[model samples]
Target: MTFENTLHFAQQLDRNDPLRSFRDRFLIPQAGGKELIYFCGNSLGLQPKAAREALDRELTVWQHLAVEGWFMRPDQAEDTPWLSIHKRCKDPLAQIVGALPSEVVPMNNLTVNMHLMLTSFYRPAGQRTKILTIGGDFPSDQYALETHIQARGMNPADVLVEIFPREGESAWRGEDICNAIDTHRDTLALVLMSGLHYYTGQVFDMAAIARKALQAGVPVGFDLAHAIGNIPLWLHDWQVDFAFWCSYKYLNSGPGGVSGVFIHQKHHNANLPRLAGWWGYDEDSRFAMTKGFVPMAGADGWQLSTPTVLAMAVHHAALQITAEAGMDALRRKSEQLTAYLEFVLRNSGYPLEIMTPADPAGRGCQLSLLVHQDGKRLFNRLVEQGIIGDWREPDCIRLAPTPLYNTFEEVWHVGQILLKFRT
Candidate 1:
């Protein structure tokens, strides 16, 4: 498809988009009574229009029923009892990530879930003690892996084998990653990697990596923070040992939204060892105040405490919108939006080196531009012009035109803004 840097071309694309109507479901941020072009879904998604109503409903439930909100369902209200609210997100999430409903569990934040999964999955024995991971994964993941190794009385330097991209290459080559796994297979206790890179917007071939590690008799896990809602995933079918992600970014839940975990049914009955809490105990007999900890079957067994009802309400609303639109339609428009943006940037004569992979299969909606000089100034200018993009340390300005709300014309307007900049 030939992309023209013209408003008419962009408008024509948007006009024919089948998911265009879904844009109205979100509340676009405004500057001086004009709607801003929010291309920041990679960092934080724009709020769904239903967020307020969702919150209000829960607040009303708490106000009226108080303690009863946990056990008893309100006669007039439509929501599930607060005790079983976690059940509401599972099916939609299972559909979104391509897993069985019992395999997914929505719980604590990303890092906390990471720690819990670490406790359960990262078992460093006498011969197999190292964790094979990539360089430049989210810092929090790095810290979690490092500290978890330390807590087990092992040096992080010895336990973590970091892999890197070839020199001069912006994105990781698939073979490089698979080869690293093979190289470390002998001593590798676990393979921990991000399914989609947050900084580079590079989508790893999770299926291939998972198969390689599993075949080598090693467990594999993924941090799906940037991958879950931004791209389609098949954690269950991929045979990924375990995975977790936050819902705020692409799922468009509120800030610090609940995170979710995927544990394959194969591991559900295994006595893999975990840090258990009362909520993780068998639900039917949990109130008996038992001495021994017998976990609820499947992923629900990972729960550590009582659930947060208020946060789940907003997330429930956000996910319903995404599930309604479906990943197939969203992915269709996402490829076009990103390709169109890359075309615009190239033709605009800006000397920006896009850090993300060129192939749509290797990337997502985000196009991370490597602005060598004065990158901060350019990012600030975009913000001043009502184009809400994200900035990272050293030199990256990320623009993510999400299919849920962003329009092709908005991407065209961003290019128009870029054309006016002198430097």
Candidate 2:
């Protein structure tokens, strides 16, 4: 995988990419008929070419059958039907996140799912009223945790413990997080953080953190919005109490596509109270006007309304592509691609700080660049050259070369462009 600074190096890397075939699998938008070098998949992934056709099938079914589509089966001889649409997508979702099919379910959007899981799991009582979290967590997570605390009649200032990086440091170490849990265990109700830091792309120690929190008599959950398809996760083995993720990023589902959830098998029969809805009731007797709410055993019990069929269809279409290519293979190429970028960027000596952790084990496909000056101008310049990356307010620009479709050649070229920006 030796790479050089010339256009030939990029073409050569593209030539050797085993997953290069996948680039054609997506819809790369072009301006004036030239393909843009897309590096923003961390925010919104490129559309799968099959997504439109999949959505059209449902549109056709709806247009022709109207309300009858809900009850009608697509294949009468088998189980394929509109009613089972959510069920159709669950298996592939589970595989992407490394959980059993029964342990995963397509449900509300990310924040909504977080709120639902909090209701069931955040049973704060006695001294366990504080929620321990990292300082640079995504804004949505911070808001959800605070709101949930306020709803429970607690002051967020006292109940929220924010673990921060050491003085003169940029990222929180795993030890610091565990120490925060240990120091505040008696008052910490939940230890929550992103499976991967949204800005820095630093992968957290979920397994170790979950074990530590559980040992300290606290529940641990994760917002996996950035990590689900970008890394190999063992949610079940890690004993994560619950987790949630949106599908539009590495999963390549279209914007506002349906999200998913995971509730570990250990909690299935536990009398943990939940904010339930009609959709969580047993499907077998749902239409029979059931007497009481009997939740459908596993993660499906967390559903509120009928699944969003159209959104789920988009996810189903995207997951099928990931399922075919396999997550492990995607991750393998991902490490190589990111490392190549890091290597080139570091050597270029750009004033931009490579804030993403260096170890492949501690991060994913994305790298957060902190440009020292004119960061916004530099971002605009990259865009002018057909390079697409997202700017996170203040100074950071995130570029994720998604392995399922992005090529190593693109990574090298983007790195060279960043170097050019510095001088």
Model-by-model lDDT, in order?
Answer: 0.92, 0.87
User: Where does candidate 1 stray beyond 4 Å?
Assistant: none
TM-score, each model? 0.98, 0.96
Kindly list the per-residue Cα lDDT of model 1 for residues 1-423, writing each as its tens digit: 888999999999999999999999999999899999999998888899999998998898899899999987678666789888989999999989989999998999999999999999999888899999999899999999999999999899878998889898888888888888899888999999999999999999999999999889899999999988888888889999999999999999989999999999999999898999888889899989969999999999999999899999898999999999998889999999999999888877876899899999999999999999899999999899999988999899989999999999999988888888844
What stretches of model 2 exceed 4 Å from their correct place? 75-79
lDDT of 2 by residue, 5-89 (tens): 6668767777887888988889997877998989999999989998898889888788877877888845443435677788888
Clashing pairs in 1: none
Candidate with the greatest TM-score versus the true structure: 1
Q: Where is model 1 poorest over a 10-residue stretch in terms of lDDT?
A: 71-80
Q: What is the number of residue pairs that collide in model 1?
A: 0
When superposed on Cα atoms, how far off is each prediction in RMSD?
Answer: 1.0, 1.6
Clashing pairs in 2: none
